[model samples]
Target: MPEYSEKVMEHFKSPKNVGEIAGADGVGEVGNPVCGDMMKFTIKVKDDRLEDVKFLTFGCGAAIAVSSMVAEMAKGMTLDEAMKLTNKDVAKALDGLPGNKMHCSNLGADALHKAIEDYRQKQAS
Candidate 1:
């Protein structure tokens, strides 16, 4: 097994914002079929800011950790700011992820960005 960071373990053990938001302003889901890792992110935006964020993830410890960390980081951020959040930033916030599992960080950010895009699309329509 990979030696995960303490922060990773912490997030996995007790992930924050773990559920979905009913009637959420936006929602996005992504998965790696080969790896069987999946994530769903939901958001509530207000005044051009992400007032709330949540996620449901199924994967390894790293995936769960990334999901939790991303929600926390994106909350209260403007839509543009959240969109700029990269996988590197998510990994750094968790104190870094094992190289073999770095892709989990990518999934986390991708899911969030997709959700943000969904929100924007809905607003524009």
Candidate 2:
């Protein structure tokens, strides 16, 4: 088993922002075939800021914890600021993840980025 940090366990056990936003401004979904982890992030943007963020994750504890961390980190951030978020930042925030599970953080960041991209795309149309 992976040696999980206390923070990771805590978030996994009681993940925050764990639902969907109705009529969300944007939605992003991603999955890893190897680990069979899937994540979906929904965001509400107001005045170019992430007014709210939420996620629905179907995966292991690490993935769930990453999703929660990403949501918390991105909330209230400007679209540009949220876009700058990276997987490494998520891992570091959690105090680190097992090497094998590091990709979970990537999924979290990617999901959030996709959501932002989706919002931008809508604006362009």
Candidate 3:
């Protein structure tokens, strides 16, 4: 049993913001090949706020759903607020994910944080 809800299946089947950004301020890619899950997240930030987010994920239904939800949640949020987003937040936004799929949410949060960090580093330079 995949433990996926209808919403999760819907998102997975038709993910939103499923592409790369042109001139993205930051891009982060993470994956566990052993698990066959990979996600690439691109972000554009302006005035310390997330102007946009997009993702391309190669994984299971849970991974796609998490990635889509992460992108939707991160956009229009300040960097500080986006950084505060945790796996729990993503899971909660999706109405809770399966225990085994928890790592998918973790991947989304980690990639978003990494992208934000990358943006900060570029701005510092």
Candidate 4:
């Protein structure tokens, strides 16, 4: 296995926003069967902004670390700002992820985006 960055290890050992938001404005769940890595992201919106964000993840250390990082990145941002977040941004926030585990970590951002989309769809209908 590849060695992880110090930041990655730090987040993995003590992930933040590591649970669901009760009555979340939006919730998204995603998984990679091949890697057996799964993630769920929940969000609360206020005035078109992400007032809060949280996540639950199962898999490797990288997955947990990325989930934490994504939540930190999304919180307190406008929906448009949060939507601009990308996998690369997630990885960079974690100080970078192991090459072999990049794909697993990438799911964090995808899950968050999905939750935001879910929230938007609900608002439209």
The model with the greater TM-score, 2 or 3, is 2
* Model 4 lDDT, full chain set: 0.90
lDDT of 4 by residue, 1-125 (tens): 57999999999889998889999999988996566799999999999999999998888888889999999889999999988999998888788888888997679988999999999999999
Q: Candidate 3 on 9-62: residue-level lDDT in tens? A: 878888898999999999988997787899999999989899999998999889
Task: Report the C-alpha displacement of residue 21, candidate 4, in angstroms.
Answer: 0.6
| Candidate 4 weakest lDDT stretch, 10 residues | 27-36
Which digits, one per residue and each the tens of the lDDT, describe model 1 over residues 1-125? 89999999999999999999999999999996577789999999999999999999989999999999999999999999999999999999999998989988999999999999999999999
Comparing 1 and 4 on TM-score, the stronger one: 1
Task: Give the count of colliding residue pairs in each prediction.
Answer: 0, 0, 0, 0
Task: Report how far residue 42 has shifted in candidate 1, in Å.
Answer: 0.4
- Number of the top-ranking candidate, with lDDT as the measure: 2
Candidate 1 global TM-score: 0.97
Which residue pairs show backbone clashes in model 3?
none
TM-score of each: 0.97, 0.97, 0.95, 0.95
Error of 1 at 119 (Å): 0.5
Error of 2 at 41 (Å): 0.3
